[model samples]
Target: MRLRLRQFRLRTGPHEHRVVQPGQPLRHTSLRAPEPIGTLLGDHDGLNRLAGLFSFAAYSRHTIVHVPLRDSVPPDEGVGELVDLVLAHHTLGLRPSRWPALRRNLVGGTPLTVRTDEARTDRDSTSWRERHERTDGRGDLRHATHARTFFLFGNRDVFASAAMSLALAAGWGPRQKGVVKGHSAFMTALPTLVQPPGGGHPLELLVCFKPYPPYAHFRRPGRRGERRSAPS
Candidate 1:
């Protein structure tokens, strides 16, 4: 099989999330996750904007990817060149294991639906999660929404996550989570097995992400005015 590369861009900084610069996370009461403090992507126009960039949904419909889901690619090569560049040089302290991932079909951005009898017990519940899982629990709790999700990730983790997201997008389908949110540049790529014009099967690469001012800093609500971002 032969493989080619295609590219796309997902401008994520426009959404509520930003990169975690090298400093204390200026914790926000209204932010998504509370940890080293990561922001979560939510059901907003931002997600829709990001989703509009990819046509994996359309591409898959038009063409056939040569690689079989069972024949998983290696972590080093699974997501392809651009992500490999990210993991290899951009990501600090991360190893190949950090990039382990699976692929799925590219579905809608978020707010995907799932069915259940009762409700969602997960930290956060969303129709998308259920759809990704593609199942509803047999119990009473069903059709839960608003599951806590990582809409954006801390800078430390974003690089690694982006690779995983791409791998995931190729398989189960593309969704909002398939992006690595960053301050200056949000990164995402699509890994697909595509049909070349010659009629043989090959792998293809698609890349994209939101663009933002590199290191736009915001003041903490309180304290000595800690910052989630540092000037680049």
Candidate 2:
């Protein structure tokens, strides 16, 4: 079935001044500075609208005009650029725990709708509502404005690893890239992407952890998500 839809991609990078890797696992530093520092990676305009993307089938359902990624994650076919952004963010040091939100923030019973009120919904959050308002909350984010919207079609782990595997396949890694391993656990735990629980299909990845603080360089990827480059 052919469906007319707008594609919106949510790809952003660490700011030039920020260090991409965390030297140590964040100690819940303070609500003001959350561990993964989601916002530190900077904002993308299409964030809100991504929640509304739909599959071709949804186009037939009148009540819903757009399909959401979590509903049915897309196959990682031609999403290399988006995947590279994921790898780079990890390479630069965003933690695995925080990566999911890079695409979706359904965590903590967060409401699906934006909080129209100006006040922060939760003091401890740089939430969807908060970010929407901070960035002027335009609900009309669409493909006309951004092209990378296609990446939002899956939950973080599967989507990220599918992309990461491509990097692994290309021989890009901490060892060859010479970049510090940001999702250190990814290197060891997932050492290589493999067929998941269902097996016999495209491989999936395991969860990655953040490095502990105090910053000791890992001798290799196996040490732990225990040491990394922290933002300066």
Candidate 3:
């Protein structure tokens, strides 16, 4: 199941040049440049193939695979093919005996498929206007339904909470080792990797958010006024 996957370190922005020359004056600015967040290891060729299979604009970058993190309303035609590709090349951290059930659930809309196309509807229609006019606690109907899916090793909620705690640590640098909390389940339906792909480091935490922007920052609102919390 182990494979040679490309490892990419996720950073918030472009690398800053700190070296100053002899005659150059020290330029000071309030703008904080991007910093490395974590590492992501994935199959380069497989990711390209997966992107080609989908009709939507899909690409892989530092922290995210630019594809829909969930299945769409009408269902994407390439979901089966994408799942097959993933199962063939990557390990879902499931045991040999659990493949059947896991495979079944995955194909049955398990939130793992990388579907990206948004549900199509008449943009200028009356129903669309009515639907968007309503508001939820976070925002109006225009607001996207935001949720997080945590990939954990043992007890789901416990590890999820632990992962969130670590993510909230703004001071965690690239060299800092992250911890995966909770006792091992031995073998279960949950996906838990002992080591991440290329780095072979202990897989501590991975959080997937549906309908996220291509970039890492989440402080700003969407074009349509949808608000998402900024990562600390």
| Candidate 1 residue-wise lDDT, 1-232, digit = tens | 0112222222223422111110111121111222222221212122221222111121122221111112222112112111111111221222223222211222122222212111221211233233433433121111101222112211212222233443333322212342223221223332221122465433222332222223134321233745557556
Cα-based RMSD of candidate 1: 20.2
lDDT (CA) for every model shown?
A: 0.23, 0.24, 0.22
Predicted model with the maximum lDDT: 2
TM-scores, all candidates, are 0.19, 0.18, 0.20
Per-residue alpha-carbon lDDT of candidate 3 for residues 12-129, written as tens digits (9 for 90 to 100): 2453111101121111100110111111111222222222222121111111112222232221111111111111111113233433333332221212233322122112122323
Clashes of 1: 43
Q: How many residue pairs clash in all the candidates, one count each?
A: 43, 20, 2
Candidate 2 C-alpha lDDT tens digits along 1-232: 1122432233446422111111121221110111111111100111111111221111212211222222222222212222211222112333434444443521222112211111211221223323444444232111110222221222222222232322232232334232243332223122122222454543322222222222244233455655545455
Worst 10 residues of 3 by lDDT: 25-34
TM-score of 3: 0.20
lDDT of 3: 0.22
RMSD for each of the candidates: 20.2, 19.6, 22.3
Give the C-alpha miss distance for residue 128 in model 2, angstroms: 35
Q: List the lowest-lDDT window of 10 residues for candidate 1.
A: 17-26
